[model samples]
Target: MPEKRRPGGNTGVWWRLIQTAARAGEDMFVAPDARSVHRGNRRAPRTEVFRPCLVGRPGGDPDREIWEGIVLDLNRYGFRIRSFAPFVEGDLVTVQLMRDEEFKYPLSGVLTARVVRRSEAGGGLMDFGMELVVEPLSPTSRSGRGIRPAPPPSLSRPGTRMHLADYISKGRGNKNR
Candidate 1:
């Protein structure tokens, strides 16, 4: 004969009690506050997420020496970067968006980010997920449309190596120490 399955197994009493409480409209457990709920929220704005990106560290030259990285996800608040090199927590970085190829121009922004989590998929490959503590460049505010023009070939030229230092020095007058 086939074995029979019980209607309730472990914690049946607990489940019954929970159902009773729910039916009574007296919450057995309190709901978390807005702040607590927000803490667990991982959803970001559409614009910040799923946008193509290139990430690199700051270097001496403002125009060169930035290691390129692809942005896997982004939000208005922060972004997740995928790069060969690992980024430590609290590291500052600059992100560039390739808007268009015809113009060969890139919309760039600078922000300070801290590494929140690191996942390794083997073969010396690591994915760095960071949270942006500082605000990134707002393309909308600068041009009044919030949309950026095409990226310049100068920014994404093939075989071009622009160090983070070059960009910093030229744009912010800051040099890597």
Candidate 2:
């Protein structure tokens, strides 16, 4: 005896439903952008930026050759900069935002910071995580000058740091930082 087929073949309908669900079950979640992956607990939210800046030694000298850098991102306590200069961790660097009329955000005049993280940004360039050792930069808004802030406890000794692995192992590289 031949097996019976349901009315207009409900099997095809059931199969199509399974197929649709299988397609839906696939990994369709969008991946997050690496640049905007800032976890909570930040003192201030990061502001996306493409401002030009000069990274140099922490001095008021006007005759020092400085590394030309572009501010990739900015925040209250820190910002990220990309430059060709191979600045080492714990190095004291000064970052001065260029006075561009097209891109002005009132963060003028030298910012002293410590190189917290270093990452290869391809093309012989590097990305430096700058943590502002100085804040509230100017005594007056229009002064555009800042008195350098003392280094935090960890970077008190400039040009001195343990290996990256060692530093991370000690939990200094936590998300909070």
Candidate 3:
């Protein structure tokens, strides 16, 4: 009979290589003074969900193909999405909400969002931090089908991110200088 290895037992020669690679997500320090630090400035609380959805450009560009992605976390203002395609900053995307993995039913026509942050999650996949860029459609348009309207001047076309404070300031007729 073969002996069973313990939980921490080394599998083989690649043990060191695998161990070092796995520490990336586990080693970020939140201490303000740390050389490598992490910060959480989110204003809205989020719900963690593993829902599938379709992502692509607005207006259904014929040349660009829509792709599938998983919503990692969602909140009122934004959500974090993981996809195989790498989206550039300032790129506007439309998310087609799906009922589930069966791909049989559609939940909503499309939600407009801007890619505020992007990071490589390895394995040719990427993680995107998206900010909802438009207001919800009126109840009359709530059949779960409506294209995104034109972006407001302050919200779109900015290479820099629009912080929550910026939004509040914009409401008071102040420009982000």
Candidate 4:
């Protein structure tokens, strides 16, 4: 009669057999080429570019409120804005990107961004790279009721800074600067 192997003895033999089989498989395996590895992989979804614009802070100092920026790049997840102003490392700011003026509302999203890196652009312009913490505002929000009116043509342009003194002097009881 064949002797039945105990649990410990059987386990040791089983482990040795698994190691031997794995070693044999490794020895016979061939490394795949980088290009071939991605042959059947599905392509990533394409991301559309949105034209970014300035959004005023509701109650912030008008001088430093409107930031000149552009949506450098974007995905469904988040976007990167190139701005002249230096935002702190972890500032919660409201960002707006322009869409069709007639029907499509502006893209407004609240992002908690961290200053990932900062570099100097020529002409004393400071560029900040921020990593967003919050999910971008949905398209529905832009189309919803209570959409704010677009800013004037002059303020809409990039690189426009209205100092506090300038704002007070130009105040005609109108929100448009």
Candidate 5:
């Protein structure tokens, strides 16, 4: 067997090479690329828009303690969020989306996900990266069939009933409609 090399033994060499190459590239009047280096590695495209949401731990008092957040970006398999609540790595949480009626895509569902990464995002907020915990239905490759629809906004709030006519009237005066 070949001799096994230890990790981190030559870390500085790689850094030096990168720095020198970057300096050389800059000297050649090359413009810095605006695209991310990870562009080609993503499973799906992400929209750079914020969607309102509520995130909470399973079986917790969602009305009393649920943290409001914005879904920063999402792909086919995972999502990133900026939340008021702190989530530890490996915690399972349910994400409920607050739909915007003006948007063309109708978002309705509670997705169960495992928190794979978390970091402090300043101002007592946190950033989380969660992977969807979808269970395959059978021996075949059908996935994500187990996702459940989110609870209605009326249920989220206690003793508040919304009328459909009231909702429709609010949009009548808006120019976007």
Candidate 6:
């Protein structure tokens, strides 16, 4: 039997409808950012940061070499940093949070954290999510007594500011004295 053709040529109505639906779906459902995927109901809350930081790994030797990074977010135990240097999961790292002009807080020490996740940020840079292998002890804990008091547990809470003494750094690596 011969096939019958439509009165006019196929304008691709079905294809057009599918395309339109796909476009609508794309618009309605946007993909979440890299941070969103890793930080699902985190045990510790993270606060957005604009502070400059140094993230370094052992370079050939145990001595730590620095890489410039912007601390995107931080908690007491971990941090999410963006840097041009790439770090792989389970890699150990050290961090030094540079003093900001606005806050003027000096924080530096060997973190000894394990990289939990690494996501590429555009422009040859990557974002790293690090979890501290061991929670840093307050300076006072080492000295037995410190002149400064410890800051409140929550850094993200409104009206709470971080103090120089509040910064935690623990364990000595070959890089750090």
Clash count of each predicted structure: 32, 0, 0, 0, 0, 0
Q: Worst ten-residue run, lDDT, model 5?
A: 34-43
Q: Candidate 1's C-alpha lDDT?
A: 0.60
Q: Worst 10-residue stretch by lDDT in candidate 2?
A: 23-32
Q: Comparing 1 and 6 by TM-score, which wins?
A: 6
Q: How close to the true structure is residue 66 of candidate 1, measured as C-alpha lDDT?
A: 59
List model 2 lDDT by residue over 21-127, tens digit each. Answer: 55542222233563442222345667889888888887768897688888998788899899998799999998889866343453587778999878899999999
lDDT of 3: 0.78
Tens-place lDDT per residue, model 4, 36-114, is: 2112211222244546655333345657567767666555444556667756555555666666543246666444455
Decide which is better by lDDT, 2 or 6. Answer: 2
The CA lDDT at 86 in model 2 is 74
Give the runs in model 6 whose Cα sits over 4 Å from its true position.
1-39, 58-64, 100-106, 135-177
Task: Evaluate residue 66 in candidate 4 and report its C-alpha lDDT on the 0 to 100 scale.
Answer: 70
lDDT of each residue in 1-177, candidate 6, tens digit only:
998878765667666556645554222112476333222235666788877877788455756567888889888878888988667998988777888734245577545778887888888999998887786688768777766766769756567876644454223333342
* lDDT of each residue in 1-177, candidate 3, tens digit only: 999878866675366446535554333234547453343335666788888889898885588878899889888888889998668999999987789797567887789999988878889989998999977578757877675787867755648877999878879997854
Q: What is the C-alpha lDDT of each candidate?
A: 0.60, 0.75, 0.78, 0.55, 0.72, 0.70
Worst 10 residues of 3 by lDDT: 20-29
> Which prediction has more favorable TM-score, 3 or 4?
3
**What residue runs in model 3 are displaced by over 4 Å at the alpha carbon?**
1-40, 136-177
User: What's the C-alpha lDDT at position 138 in model 5?
Assistant: 64
Per-residue CA lDDT of model 5 for 42-136, tens digit only, reads: 45556555887778887756465677788888877878889987689999998887877343343767789899878788998899988889875
- TM-score of model number 2: 0.49
Q: List the residue pairs that clash in candidate 6.
A: none
For all predicted structures, in order, the TM-scores are 0.42, 0.49, 0.54, 0.37, 0.49, 0.49
